[model samples]
Target: MNPVKTIQRLWLLFLLQIPFALMAQHPVRLAVAGITHGHSDWIYNRKLRGDIEIAGIYETNADRVQEFRKRYQLPENLFYTNLEQLLDKVKPEGVMAFGPVNEHIAVVRACAPRKINVMVEKPLATTYKDAQEIADLAKRYGIKVLTDFETSWYASNQYVRNSYKEGRLGQLRKVMINDGHEGPWAMNRHFVSWLTDPVKNGGGALMDFGCYGANLMTWLMEGQRPLSVTAVTHQNRPDRYPKVEDEATIILQYPEAQCVIQASWSWSFSRKDMEVYGTKGYAIAADPVKIRTRMQGASSEVSQTLEPRSAPFNDPFAVFANVIRGTLKLEPDDVYELPVNVTVVEILDAARTSAKSGKTIYLKPRPALVQAGNVGNN
Candidate 1:
């Protein structure tokens, strides 16, 4: 046996095994802060799959707490009635929020001082003000704050990005995004009330689904601010959702391109899909599972049933687990990052204002509060 060659080979093997070793050694300890929103399924279901172990869960709604307890078969003690109590007892490594869009800040505030990382369902919060607080706390505590989106896990979206970068998708022109469903009520009536309330959930479909289009367009534009935003919103089902608009159409104008964000709660069925049109080609992300691409003057087209990119990008559970072990770092500009979500909220705010004013509104990127480490130009 050659000692020198054997030593080099052994070192290579060890280097290759490092990541797997770290992954197997310990799983991330997580706790859920709220289970009221229907989106909580994103977190709790993962626990059911044994994908992630939630050390604790919390909710003040007795009915919801009992319902989730019955569904998950969680022990009485595994569910806490208070946020601080859950954190104090379990001392989990991180917390994943599944509460109302409005409570994102309170959840982060509770977890920040403890140095626990947090990931909330998309939009970051109900307003830009809350997002600002989230960023400040993240900077002060030096903990990761993530906003997860089901779009971030789609291969079709990634394929479009890859094509554009490779010069195959051609010069970007317009992005059309339609995201929503028949309504939150079609999913769960109890959750629908807060979801439809302007105060608790912001502004119906515009608030709930508008963030998706904004986040996608922001990422597609490489964080460019829109010249102006024009929007119209209305309640197609005012009898059912009198407090908020159930549908909205927002147009965002960029220097070289434009985007149409169609967010609605009045669709015949559930939807969260997009289409990208460029001078030389076009791509359609039909739901998350399918993608079709056509190139100008090409002999044929390409289609894909895209698989998830990898861990972290694959799902929220995978991402947070790696984050806890210090393996994955969230980019400041990443869709899940604070700055990106702030822009999302900002756009939603403008959309709402535009809807109410019945006019176009200009948008400027607000200088990030914690801009010290912003990635693109910092």
Candidate 2:
């Protein structure tokens, strides 16, 4: 071939190889701590993306491992019965817990000493004690511990949050958050077993879906602990959820705002929507991507559809990847931050207590509670 033709051929080859090179570059190496949680499907079911790669998975149940492997066609070598061994083998950059809520502490305990960050599904822990321990461990090890919520990735929620922060919503007044569906009893046995267990899941809808509202409210309050928590719970389906309540309603009172959280497994249909009312206007996150709003003096409410969020905000794994790679920095009370989730766990804990006692529970002042892992760093 002529020299000019040879050079042209080389340039064409380089262009052809660019996409392959980019596809294989800088994918976040992540480990799954457990695969029993119902939400564990999030990892396996997500559309393939170049930004995240599952390095290893640890599940104590051999049957579950086999089932998942067959279902997802995952490699045999990628499965491990021991978490620590899985971590040592793959050396993942972070661990995402797909275990029972109480088991989050174990995941963090193992990863923290290794200086590996962790992200757990919502509520952080089954109890406040575990949440505090996880927080302390992360602080001591200088690793990031995040709690992931599906709502955190919602464009509508982000839009509402931005509107509030930018003063479009004006001073906060009340927020109403509705969450949950018609129970998890119909889910797989592995998921249903732990999810309805009092110890494994903390509580029923109060701990399962209640955390969403608590997490959002804490973030909206900028990590402020609620002044008081009042709650009522009902066990509507004794045949299905024999051990836990199927319905919960919680009231969070702030100095100048109040939030009503309706979390139920008895809803006629699934929903995860919230309404934020301020002095000047109100915004309703109708769903993940739709927002209904009414501004001060506006005659009619307006509904707007939002585009998908940009990278690092569009999905939980994206956020985790960006944070681990130092491309994203979490604000003090960003919905996913540890402190906000800690407060969320606190609120859930209080809600459980109030429901049990049929009395409102008063909380300590913000400063006093901060010492005990109540707030995130500003």
Candidate 3:
């Protein structure tokens, strides 16, 4: 072959390889630790979709492992009796920690030393100190840690967020969120083991549901941590949840705005609604998938329904994969940012304190200098 023709053929082959190289760059391998949360369904769905390969599962109890395998149709080979064995063998790209709140710290501690990224289920930790320790370890090792606040990543919520950013709501004034379900009785039996235990679950209805409201409030308000929190929780169903409170209301005060969040485990109504009020207009997310807005003097209300794209786990998992692949950059203030999860823990802690004392509890201010660049590296 002529030298010029051969050189041209080699160049053409190199150009063709670019797309395949990008595709092979980062393939996410996920191992799930402690599948006790009911939301494990999302993770199971992701595994089925081929978005993430299920490297293994770590569960302490044999019976629970059997139940998980049977319920989710997970292969027997994927179950690891011990977490350490699972971590060492799987060497997964990341771990999904959906264990009980009391067990959260220990799981994170175990994974942190291995420099493994973790996506933990929220109420980040059982206590403020434990949460801080996890945060400190994450920082020390430079690992990406995320809490599973799936609603914050919902496209409908994104629409509302965009409206807020565009000043469609004008100056923010107040935000109200109501996320109440039937009760723990309606929840899966697995949740009963830990969720009703204040020692295990951290707090009652407020900690379980109010965290969503608090997270959304902070997320939409541009990462303004709550200045103070006041809350009241009642044991409406002492017969069912004898040890835990079944109803709760929390008020969070911010410097520029205030938010009222109500959650009830014993409520008759099934509602997940949020209304954000601003100087010029108001926006409401009637459900997790719809955003509706009304501006002053507007002839018609603006409405948007999010088209189904990826499931909750798939969306975050894809983002996490990109981060690991160095294609997506994670900002400090982003809700998925690890430090923000730490802040969420602090706010929930303050809320618990307020609920117990029956008084507004003040929170320590976040450091001024640590801005958007200081979060987990993507």
The candidate with the higher lDDT, 1 or 3, is 1
| Residue 323 shift from truth in candidate 3, angstroms | 2.9
Quality of model 1 by C-alpha lDDT: 0.82
lDDT of 1 at 241: 89
Off by over 4 Å in 2: 1-24, 366-378
In model 2, how large is the Cα lDDT of residue 108?
90
lDDT order of candidates, top first:
2, 1, 3
Q: Per-residue lDDT of 263-286 in model 3, one digit per residue for the tens?
A: 889777777788999998999988
lDDT by residue (171-195, candidate 1, tens digit) is: 8998999898887766665588688
What local distance difference test score does each model get? Answer: 0.82, 0.88, 0.78
lDDT by residue (175-292, candidate 2, tens digit) is: 9999989789889899899899999999999999999999998888887888999999999998999999999999999989999999999988999999999999999999999999
Better of 1 and 2 by TM-score: 2
lDDT of 3 at 54: 70
Question: Which one wins on lDDT?
Answer: 2
- Model 1 residue 284 lDDT score: 92
Residue 297, model 1, lDDT: 88
Q: Which regions of candidate 3 deviate over 4 angstroms?
A: 1-26, 308-314, 366-371
Q: Model 1 segments beyond 4 Å from truth? A: 1-23, 47-51, 299-301, 370-378
